[model samples]
Target: MLGAGLLAAAGLPATRAAAATPASTSVLISGSLASYSTFESKWNYLYPWGDSHNGSALMVASSSNHNHVSLSGGVLTLTSTPYVGDGFNYHSGTVYAKQQVLVDSSWPSWEVSGDFQAPSAKGTWPAFWLTGVNSWPPESDILEFKGSATNWSNTYKNTSGAWSNTLTPISDPGAWHTYRAVLKKSGSSNVQIQYFIDGVLKGTHTGAGFVGQPMWLIIDYQMEGSSGSPGPTTTTYFRARNLYLARSSS
Candidate 1:
């Protein structure tokens, strides 16, 4: 996931401010839903060549030859393998929901929930996050595991040119855990975000100037960032299952 600081470093536009107001009463949309079993038809592999990163790993589109990403047994696997190409020494996986699977004005209130086994390798960075389809600084990172040192998940929200983050410690990152994020437009251009882990609320953040904008989901296993240089020399993997998305009915 791109942190607020990293977003700024990438020359993305700053977040805009919106007036604070009462929260919106949003409910899950009855039929706007998806899961791993239906993922392929609803998602697309993100070609990873023009993105910012300090890692040596390059993301590749899903293909028979590469097999960087795969879906089977109701689970999705994103693997990072050692490869020598484009002067880089590794290859990993990244995928995003199809453009049609966007949270826009028609469905501003939304939720993404899933079970994941976070990779614990020293130099791995895995995240389940959301970003604006047509803008920046409106990102919401539901779960981000930086490495073994940070054996926990961090949730981040960028709004009003600022970032709000909360760290929830986990004893074993390799163990499967439930992660979820619920977002609702609370005002004309503001959203209220709530993060949950294993059904327990971990954090809440409100983002300004982000309401009613189209946002897309991203799940990736990046090799390195602030985690350090020289990522795992061997293969590493991130796995997720029971992934789901839904929109508000009201």
Candidate 2:
């Protein structure tokens, strides 16, 4: 487990889960605009915004002409071209399953697991994250960008003032891979958060500040370039599939 580092740019609901509690659930936010749960834009800032802010993340949808997100065979595929904004440029897309549609009905008490095809290149940052209905950064980020190269790895932020860590995967992220985060309800004795890579336990957290509250799932493409990372020289894209969200039986 890696310690929470200095900074980097930043950046669910109930129901579906209640009606159908699959031992595992696949979360794919794509295709027709109606397929997505509505998301209200929160923070639009760049990053490291003054002393660890809250209830805000940087995510935007594609313009009509640029929009290219879809759900095929239960997989959420996201793609887009470069766009100028916030003193920087980005060419990625994002969709949220928020509002009436949610992953869980409470807070500090949710787990998201799935396989993701990590983005290849320095500029690409893809993630599976969640946020509070009222606060921003406070939401947990289960998985994040796994850079392309030696020693490249993924990271997580338990924004609830819980715990955060960086993880190194055994396999290359260029190909499809599985990742999971189990957020157990905080108890008077033991509160824990577990992370797994490709079905292997990688890390765990305690005092995660995770309680019972509803949260929604969100997936998106992120770029680190202030100007869109040279604009994807060769058709780069992001894919997240076979996702599952289950409330702990305990």
Please name the candidate that would achieve the greatest TM-score relative to the true structure.
1
Model 1 misses residue 118 by how many Å?
0.8
RMSD of each: 14.2, 14.9
Assess candidate 2 and give its TM-score to the true structure: 0.61
- How do the residues 182-228 of candidate 1 rate in per-residue lDDT, one tens digit apiece? 87777677778888888999888887777666667788777777566
Q: Candidate 1: misplaced stretches above 4 Å? A: 1-38, 47-54, 99-108, 149-160
lDDT of 2 by residue, 133-248 (tens): 54443355566663453222222234355446655644567677787777665554234666777777777755333343344566656666321245454446778776565553
Question: Cα lDDT of all candidates, in order?
Answer: 0.69, 0.49
Backbone clash numbers for all candidates listed:
1, 29
| Lowest-sum lDDT 10-residue window in model 2 | 6-15
TM-score of every candidate relative to the true structure: 0.77, 0.61
Error of 2 at 162 (Å): 7.2
